[model samples]
Target chain A: MPRETSRDNMLREKHGKEIDDIISRYPVRRSALLPLLYLAQREQGYVTEAAMKEIAQILKLTPPQVYETITFYTMLNLKPVGKFHIQVCKSLMCALVGSDQLVGWFHAKLGIKPGETTPDKLFTLSVVECLGACGTGPMMQINDDYYERLTEQKVDQILSDLKKTGACPLKSGPFMWPEARSAK
Target chain B: MPKHELILLKNMMTPGYTGSLKDYEKTGGYQALKKVVGKVQPADVTQLVMKSGLRGRGGAGFPTGVKWNFLPKDYKGPKYLCCNADESEPGTFKDRQLMERDPHQVLEGIAIAAYAIGAESSYIYIRGEFVLGAHILDKAVAEAQQAGYLGKNVLGSGANIQIYVHRGAGAYICGEETALLESLEGKRGLPRVKPPFPATSGLYGKPTVVNNVETLANLPHIVNRGPEWFAAIGSAPKSTGTRIFCVSGHVKNPGNYEVPMGITLRELIFEHAGGMRSDKKLKAIIPGGASAPFLTEQHLDVKLDFESVAQAGSMLGSGGVTVMEEGTSMVWAALRLMEFFFHESCGKCSPCREGSSWLTQTVRRILAKRGRMEDIETLKQLCQNIAGRTICAFGDAEVAPIMSTLQYWRHEYEELIREAEAHREKELPMAAARH
Candidate 1:
């Protein structure tokens, strides 16, 4: 039998109550797989093998079942990503509005290709599909926030701000929460 | 219509309408739920929707009332209402606006649908990329539960309804009803074959009614204003009610415009969307989301309704209008759209999976100046093979861009091949000199 590592034990010990709460939302425990995977990704930087096994055990699913779901979803990362993952929208609408140029700019500035993490591990560059923010084109999502209507100058400013302060200073569009409610 | 009477998007444009349950209540949000529970029969709500001529806004144009009526009448099992908040269609973003700006509106719609369909539990399967929208909905569901609108014995009618938000992990196929059921069941988002559709057996082998976010958002107004008022809004009889047209790409003011059905594409682009950007000459237009065929400048006068657009060799799919200027390359556009399809094929069926890859490769070769003259016909033949073979509409959708572009711009492909041959001939001399 395979032994349990301390990391696995720690993850379960930390997220036990929250995992139970999420599982309780659905009639079947297997239905909670996606949300539990999301929770694991949130707790760790990305979904690790240990995290998948732990999630499977909690949801009464085999680890292979959990792993298959993890592989299917684009949002769930298997390997570790940087603290701030910058995903640029490269779909039809965004592509029409110079998302290719935006991707080029990120490559030049970050010195990393689309699916690569920087050496410092501060940022990872990725090109994703339509984030449903097509109205505001040339958009990029850094962590949980989106920075839309991008220009070279805006990209430079955003990168510099991120480098200096470890945070994105720019705001998302009017459709986002908190700011959306207050906007006219 | 003077200002396009807005039903679903009424609170969206209002100032200080912060999507709060309180603000939504002020605008008469949950009144429909209050009236439906213990007051109106479940079948009557379906009848009202049928009278309203409400159709699915999620590209299918399926009659909403007809779909709700498909559920077995005295089924003893637990029924479910799954709201398709997974708006990942390439150019469609209207549902995101509705959910982000007026979350309670959608929640109230879900509540009413749950009551009307005799569903004890409902799930809003939202896209994973909609982080803020999901958060807003989470808060809205909690607020509704707290206010005695969503939880057990909802409004003291003895009808229990609980709404939960399920986030999808960035797959476009999940927007399809059965694929959505599969994803909700914690499997890959592979679309299932019909005949045992979601209305009969869905969400763990029970009767289900999967609805678009915009489709459900119209419920409150339909119940309050009566079906006749809703049916009278649109110009067309079959496609009734206002549709939120998300106009993006090359328009001066690219945003969501909630206009009445059957509005002219010319009016939607020139008047409402502030015309084309930079005063450039228009070349092509994608009247719907990426799945719909591309229409040329001649189609500017086409009506932006399902039937009219269908007559014009396209669909009013999700009402996503994408405009392209004169400088845009038709080959490049086709290639880019093919790239999207190739990436999102889901690989459930061989035709969609392998055909999309080959089509993408052919288009990329053309773009890279390495394509043969016969490749254009090859692409068309491949599209013909793929469209009607797959289990879902995705197979048909994957061919729209290639087929439509080839129909309108065959000369463009010929010109590209000639240019490539000329460049290659010129390079042959340089190769000789180097040798």
Candidate 2:
């Protein structure tokens, strides 16, 4: 039941199968650069040259090709990220709503700027552009989930929950639904 | 409608202006070109355009005649009149409608432009997604060539003009003139630094005049109607002619509404768009396409002109109006648009390339209910760093949704934060629900 212990062994042994599935999805094998990097990062926690070369071999592309795409898109982290990756929206719309305050909160709470990981490796805070939820104003994301209608207290709760259980809970309150808000 | 006069919309939806020489001839299509072909010089054609006050319709609103005047009359280089048909603006689909309904009108305009600029060849650089429109343009071009209105001696004037349709890989940046030029040259679609503008340097480093589809469509009418008569439409003595406003989104009837430039937003949205779909109340409206800032319901009376829209802290951007009814959450809409910007960043500049993705992640996190209070201010600051600092308007374009939403509805975000705090009081673990 331990997550990393057996899952690590399974990932290590099944990494090749994952690589093949990712590579086969693209018409041009080179298009698998992002997925391959993601897999390599997922397994090794960072994109090492050896892992990149293995990805290159699997996808029939040069390491530079993979490197270029990885470097080009900001979503793929070349290095390790904190357990909780907090990306704050930093485009004009988000700024107008107060993304600056979000960044400041992260700085005050996590002690890190836009692109750096926290010293404790528990959180990595980065600033990003419009996340399309301009209506919510002043919002951010931690990994896959989005937290709308953000507030300092909610942020503290999110951090506290994340620290306790290693994951942020999905929004279940009636207020969290877009349909409910639409009716308002 | 009553004997549509000259320059721009001359052959506009006229009977049979497609790829048939006989059809075009039936409509008196090539008559203006024949009138000036050998008799009038290229400089005289430029003079006519200058006098007409035709401005570029590709969102920049630069004077069309002045742009042609910028090209060296005697330089004799590879001057090009590129018809920018890459209509990628999210809410703007008027160009597609024009090309689909009337292709010959645009071809005739291209012919006249090529002759006026002394461009031996003209290329209609289209968005690749316009497969059907491309076929129609090609067929029309062939028809025009066969009729001698293009290629060899046009109507016995001994002047030659070649029209070609070049397709572009779907990239929004290519809508930028220089980037469109770059895409035409078969390269990555990235915007070039301006100053040389397109007149001094364009296409293959030669002088090129990148004209919009609607702007080029106005040419045949300008020639037929003559300069003085053609300059008297719309509001504002300075701003001449009728403009097409594509009314879309929450409107009862969403379509291209061609009206005089001086109409109010209220008229366009109410009289033209038939008001909101459900009469549920119009919360906000994006006057231009996605890139322009939002205008709340209070600003509906603002005149729908380029200058008026700008004065109200928004733009008449491509005249693509999108209405958001009261029930719509600005946050969700901003997220959706951010996803688009992040997906279409093109990765040419650092701020836009990185900033867009970062914005998406941050917003997604907030939407996922794992957001923090400081995310709002962080988003605002991030947008500030990205806007006006990128190589192209893409960065600024990406900023419109979030900034405008916050401008009109910061309290909504605060309310969400408050709700989250209230929910926290229920003794329920908030991190378990992940939808």
Candidate 3:
């Protein structure tokens, strides 16, 4: 975790302006907690306790108030997720389309199940609810972008490409490449 | 496939809707605003809505009139009326359908609601991801403004209602009314603690009414068709009107189905959704999105209404019905939902933040063929702690999947654990020592 001093500075420098902008939009200050956290998280990869404390201070809220806001929604990650945080959609629509096998494959390749960061810190895998892209199920989101219609072979190729490209890989939503074989 | 039923509810969803003022005017849109403006007092409108028993279509089933009534008539500050278009709930896409197909309907609904609530300005808080839908709504609002339906002196009645379409930054929690208001204020989408409720203290600390897209869509019809007509359609005595259920998964026909409130699950799936897709028989149904309690084949005949579903130990949440065929494992399905709640958990409370993680881990342990008999009981205990303890229903939403799955499919979980134990014994032989 980043130290409190640096986190505080980041919140003051980046999140402070964003928090002001968000709070100004709302007639209420308490509602600014979510966006402030988002801005805080973007400034720092994950929300440290220090950053959360500062957020509470900035919003004229208690630490619990900030904690309650963070705990209510799922998009904000408090702990450090890997450089490429792989979020697989394991909800009903995606499950029917074979999200399980893909998840298992990720477990094998990454050596970490959902919620575990890889030893090398290259990836952190977690399962999410329906990403609202049910039409393209068996999908995974890496960072901000989405990758749909996954297969083991495709997973292998995608991993290889991610390994090759230090930067986040481009999204390839199912239609781009056919799976090696039809398990069906 | 409902074959796109164009009932009185979907009057504004005509194809090739350009959202132009002339187009909406030609279609007899905004006439209700013209009809209700001078003729209807805000209290009379509120009474009409109260009599109709129009509960919020958003997750909470609070009565719409009651919500509007909560706004302090004595307060002289600026109040807001927010249209919650952040349709991020899993399996729930009814709002998206309403917005995409019928933008003007929603706008008209907003106008009626603003008039009823005594609000001068309203904001349609749309989700960021809904680019197309937002565009349609934005254009519709602009058209309503041009047609003297949204701006100052709407329909020449001197009741000025200015509607602004505020786009959200793609957060699911914003679907919650207060969170939607917060996001509309250009903040991150996080839910607020209730009690003061939006009607009393919402949007900018004024008395705001944050209604869902579907709930607001019903406003114009309630004003135009009369509340009595709406009350007569649905199943419950207090709850009125048709509900749009977005049926998906393992079904032959999966789409948005709008039916009278008292319709049965059997009718919805077999008659409306065209039954299960494969030869695989129905295993279970998550009747009301991921948050609601799961129902087995036994509850298929249960009436799909808020009260009936609640009586049966589940809610008619967002009316997103997901079907699971026999080929699917109930254990996996439950785990999948748990995983969603785990990842989606904003991680504020120890019970929910930690409990969801624990549930997902336990489910994974069970699925990975590394199961313990004690883990099942621990899972139940964890769920017990998580439920009703958090700031939002999210904690309770997390519990439904865990408890419902265990209640309906305990045998399946036992089988998975036993299967895993056997596999561990055969493969590792000394795997027990590792633990």
Give the candidate number with the greatest lDDT.
Answer: 1
Q: Per-residue alpha-carbon lDDT of model 1 for B38-70, expressed as tens digits?
A: 899999999999999999989898999999999
How accurate locally, in lDDT, is each candidate?
0.87, 0.71, 0.75
Docking class of 2: incorrect
Report lDDT (Cα) of residue B63, candidate 3: 93
lDDT of each residue in B6-98, candidate 3, tens digit only: 343344334455545666567777777778886888889889999888998987888999888888887777878988877777887677667
Single out the weakest 10-residue window by summed lDDT for candidate 3 chain B.
B1-10
In model 2 chain B, the worst 10-residue window by lDDT is B1-10
- Binned by DockQ into CAPRI classes (incorrect, acceptable, medium, high), candidate 1 is acceptable
Q: Which regions in candidate 3 have their CA more than 4 angstroms from the true location?
A: A1-89, A99-128, A133-184, B1-5, B12-21, B184-190, B423-435
- Which candidate has the top score in DockQ? 1
Better of 2 and 3 by TM-score: 3
Instruction: Enumerate the candidates' DockQ scores in order.
Output: 0.49, 0.02, 0.14
Q: For candidate 3, what is the DockQ? A: 0.14
* Model 3 residue B127 lDDT score: 64
Record all residue pairs in model 3 with backbone atoms less than 3 Å apart, i.e. clashing: A27-B204, A35-B188, A70-B346, A71-B346, A71-B347, A71-B348, A73-B346, A74-B344, B235-B262
Q: What's model 2's overall lDDT? A: 0.71
Evaluating just chain A, the predictions reach TM-scores of: 0.88, 0.81, 0.82
